[model samples]
Target: MASPVSSPKKNTRNRKLCTPPNHSLFFLSLLVSMITFFGISVLSFMPISLQDSYLLPLLSPSSEPFSSPSFSSAENRSQVTLASLALTFLDSEENEPILSNSVMVPLPAHGIVGSNVSEEEREFWRQPDGEGYRPCLDFSIGYRKASVRITEEKRRFLTVAVSGGLNQQRNGIVDAVVIARILEAALVVPVLVVNQIWRDKGEFSEIFDVKHFKRTLQADVRVVSSLPSTHLRSRQTIETMQMPSDVSPLWIRSRFLRKLNGDGVSILKLQGLYSRLSKNLPSDLQKLRCKVAFHALRYAAPIRELGNRLARRMRIEGPYIALHLRLEKDVWVRTACRTGLGAEYDDIISKIRGSQPEYLRASQNMSYLQRRLAGQCPLNSLEMARLLKALGAPRSARVYRAGGEPFGGKQALQPLVAEFPNLVTKDNLARDGELSQYSNRSSALAAIDYIVSLSSTVFVPSHGGNMGIAMQGHRAYVGHRKYIKPNKRSMLPLLEDTTISNAEFSRAMRKLHAKSQGQPEMRTNKRDRDVLAYPVPECMCKHSVNNDVSHH
Candidate 1:
């Protein structure tokens, strides 16, 4: 061998000569090393300016490297620096990339860090816009119209005595509104007669806001708490007229108007007033019914405040369900549900049934299955619990019981409470003396229930009652939130069939109520007995452009 250093030079020359003068391979290797060195240097510096440009282009065969004359300028240098920094950032540990240019980069889905540009773009579309999704009634928009005050050509007043349970009274009030419009009479706010069954002693003003009620109906109908002092003094001049049990709009226009024309003030003592959906009423009057029921019939401030406070306390991050469990003492007796309670409770049911109305006495003669099919029996606590479970209501679901005490109180609710520990009641949420003032007062208590039920995420009524029907209609008019109307008629056979598996029962229940959830349209034909229960096509307006405009 030659001298050590001379020997290495001789070997390198020999290897180069043996490679057949491959200039392409030699230059390619040198270019790659230079590019790698440049990337390392750029990343080390990480200049703030190089935060948004496309860095991968530098490695692309089609694009020239940073050796271009344009990149030598100060502005171009900044752009190069930005692009380098952005690449470095993308390589580093950051959630989103900071690219100088809108370069499409492949990214992973799922997690934030590994997620790509395409996923981020998709997420941008998924995010909720400002104001969010408001599916309910916008009270602000509802009250935007200028107040409408009716000018009665004839100076006549109509004073009506309202009678019935909480719901009956409510229906009567709605009917009274329509009647007042037809007769063109100044309405005297009807009294809320004490419910004989529940023994409710609450007055109209005690539960509802008297001032708000009068002010709201001022435009549609002249409503007053009492007759004017001038009219009161002229008692003899005031002709007391009792409305017939089956009085029609035509009858009122013809015979009724003739009698009131000569009178100083006609006090129309009204009774058994309920919505007559078949009658071809004025469209304005129909809307007025909605205004009277929803807008005008607001609860007293104190009751509303209490209801809101209770709802807030009960609600977690999400909305709560208001289950109007109509399994009160009166309901059990009226429906004769004692047959299933065995002989131990037979005497109790018998005594309770004795106190019920003559109509309910006939229910005692019918079998449990017959009563259930007829929709006469209210769903018991156990049945309600099973139904809720089958409906896939989460275990942690916040349930607010809207009605009075169940038939068996805490004992009866144990099964439901065990399954859904978050279940609460007005009494449970409220302190002992907080709602004591309105204790035993059914109407006032119902008002509290109404406020809470109205604000609920979901409303499930065990049976059709005044509060249930009103709440259903109210929710429908508002953004049509989830109102689960259980098919009690069909549910009876399934619930009674103990042979069925839990999974099968749940599947059947879900299928039975598939259409009942969300926004369901009520039958508009003559078959619809309770048109006031779902006054959507007539009462509600589409809140947004995206909503179905067919009903509007």
Candidate 2:
């Protein structure tokens, strides 16, 4: 009977039909089609910068998959959430991405990706991967764990005179640690050369917490208060070493290695150590710099207490704006730029600049108006006022002005004060005699400024000085609080145009600064581009989920 049944030739094709339908392959094919259809629409929004790096391979019929790039520039093109992107790939049942037709129809998917979108509005409402990557203040990337090689008998010390004002000295101190590491020598607490302008006698210990500096860098470099007692017998106070500017890691090791080993216990001192070390060092060195600047260089306990107190007072009313108003005599003289306080102020700056060859002119070719428009000069008080107002500075928001005394004195800040009357400096906010204690100590005062600026809800720098650069980097190192770096070149043109209404100017300002909002960015190897300024993808790490901020 079975043979009889078999005689039907088993209906080979029918037997195949009888089996359960294997729809997996069919579904996969359908998915691929759906993706291809919508991918065209998604590809439309693909940022031009990323088009060359990836996506092309993905679009092509290739056997091999696209190798993931180290960074994603998708955030530059669109602040679209990763979830929306996921939904775009998802099956029909799930929440759908803006359909292929929606791209043409221009329906709101989440928020439209463009300059009109406010920075705060673009914030992803959900928590980021690393506990929202916030208290975004984690610049310490296992630096505490990395061990420093200790040389017992032939201990060597690198003494560096960290010159310039507070931020400049801060950078120099950072360089000293890195150079010490490169030379494999212990670092002495940096010597703070009193700045001539501020007449600041603030020592390293008076400015930065020495114990914290030493302990924080114990694993990275041995930081000592001074050379060992044995080295004090030397005829020279500190053996001087001439280091090149923007020195490479190899150059440092090669040049200083012999010097360190020359004597049993040596102390090599170098002054004006700013920009001496290369910016694009090995990632470890860059990170070490970040560790020093962000963590190790804490203000002295007293300074911290005063700074905290002042900061508390400043913010007590409401979240304040830390404006780094660079309107000092030196700034005007050096930049050789106009103040927009009228020809009188400009004439004064010109007279001072012409009188002193010591003062720098950014470029011989760039003239005053040219420099101002080019953003080569610092934003004048009037410009700062317009910018702050255009950026929607709350009429009542207190602005904590950080930097030296304005060039025009109280008159220099009249425009800003008039627009936002709550503009207060450390002196204004300080309890009587509180700042008097550190009166002559500019570094200490700037350190106080630094602390307040770092802790502010919004930090705006009028010019790109050492302090501004450092503050921007520090602000980013912490949570990326609003840092509106005036797009000097583009912005000045907009600001000077008398025809545009306030609303239009505000729109333009928002558009110009949309991407300049203190986003974390890795430092480029461009010659003299400071690493401390751009401390991202090197000093900072982020979860893949936070690719929106990967401004690498």
Candidate 3:
């Protein structure tokens, strides 16, 4: 108090010593300013309703509008500040169009519901009573009658040499059998042509039951394993005939048979002979094609046993859903369905396109939808999952995938697996040795898939390729089973529409496929035959009716 200026300097020195520094105060002010700025920014962008209702309450606790809160404690003030910031952030996010518009529709828990599934759909899935479950036919009496007719008459031996994959070979064999029966020739056991598709050297007898084949068709046509030694000796003397592309019963009866009479044993060298479903064929010959395809083409003992075992393993109390997801690398490449796979997969698409046949390559001018509608491309895994979910396949359904590992492996199958967690394959169910036996044999592996698919309660094919077509035909022939033939062409647009909600998309799909389920109508026109896979009337008969009637 002696000197005023000196006293002020001493006071300042004392204040500096008592209070540490201005740095802490500066940081606190900066943080509060930043939070206020951030909160204002968030609120400015928020929807008007959110700002008035949600943000207003968080920012000002007092009921009076925009009134600054008087906090009793620092904790109260801090709590209010933190809450307002959080609400601002949350409200801002909630107003985002992407999040607000997205709708994830869950699939039916038990099965598909709604008006889409009809009575025929219900009956198709229902388990058959007693022996009706089995698709076995009694061709014994017919075989015996046909046998007597053939043995009594001196029939000319006809050896049909054909080639292709299993289904193609099977189709060829059916056509060959009908040809032999038409010409009244003793049919040589048809050869299963070895090719790069399966990469197996196994003979026809090695994969198929030669004895069963011979025994089953003994009456309809004499199915000999090979050309008789007598015929082999006179091989050079045998007359060779190339089957005309448009072969008919009239052609076989009127002209072809006369060529076989003078020769030691005519060799009918048939190529691409899958045209047995002609509308003009005699009913008996048509029935014979059915008998051979549906009844007589039984797999060998090992294959049958393995297929059954795999089927049993897949079924858990109820019949499993067989998904023939034809997403293998070769098939995918051939079909050129690559669209939304992204940059990483572009090289793969390019490589695949480069390798395909010129005509099959996806044209640059054609749209993705065009390619898909024309059935030139298969549904990608994601699209397949979406379609299945829409069809009312529950997430918990047991799905047995028929084909090999998909093109993209885990990445491609992720969506399907997520939807159907219980999905399985032969590789997962079968023992190492069991699968190893047919490891290199693609056809045998495919046969296993075929058998499992045949035994499934519901069969759905992702694409209408050979495996799918064969399975569809087999399922139809066995009985009018629940075969969900997806109307991919109709469903594609709905899937591509981002504007549509998940529920809306699913509803549209269900409506589109309402009548497409189960055994489709048998198409009569040769051009439309492929649509139904198996023309039911031509290839299948009611088991009861088949057993009661006797062949002439």
State TM-scores per candidate: 0.68, 0.72, 0.68
Q: Write the per-residue lDDT of candidate 2 for residues 163-215, one digit (tens) a residue.
A: 77777888888888888877777777888887666677777777777766665
Q: Could you arrange the candidates by lDDT from highest to lowest?
A: 2, 3, 1
How much lDDT does each candidate structure score?
0.61, 0.65, 0.62
Runs in model 3 deviating more than 4 A are 1-155, 235-246, 253-255, 276-280, 343-346, 355-369, 523-532, 538-552
Residue-wise C-alpha lDDT for candidate 3, range 1-552, written one tens digit per residue: 467566988888878899856898899889999988886676545432223233333443332212233456675565456456645454342232111111111111123345755553444354322122212222334544664676333337665555656777777778888877777777777767666445566677777777666655654666777666775666433545555656667866776656666645565544456654454565456556656776577787898888878887776445568888877766656566673456667578667577655425456788766788776677777888888777666666678988876776788888878887888889989886888888788778878888888777778888776667766665554444567887877776787799999889877887887666663455454543642265444433222311222211
* Number of the top lDDT candidate: 2
Scored by TM-score, the top model is 2
Report RMSD (Å) for each prediction in the order shown: 22.3, 15.2, 32.2
lDDT of 1 by residue, 29-106 (tens): 999999877876665344212221234334232321111234555766655665565565453332223221211111
Worst 10 residues of 2 by lDDT: 100-109
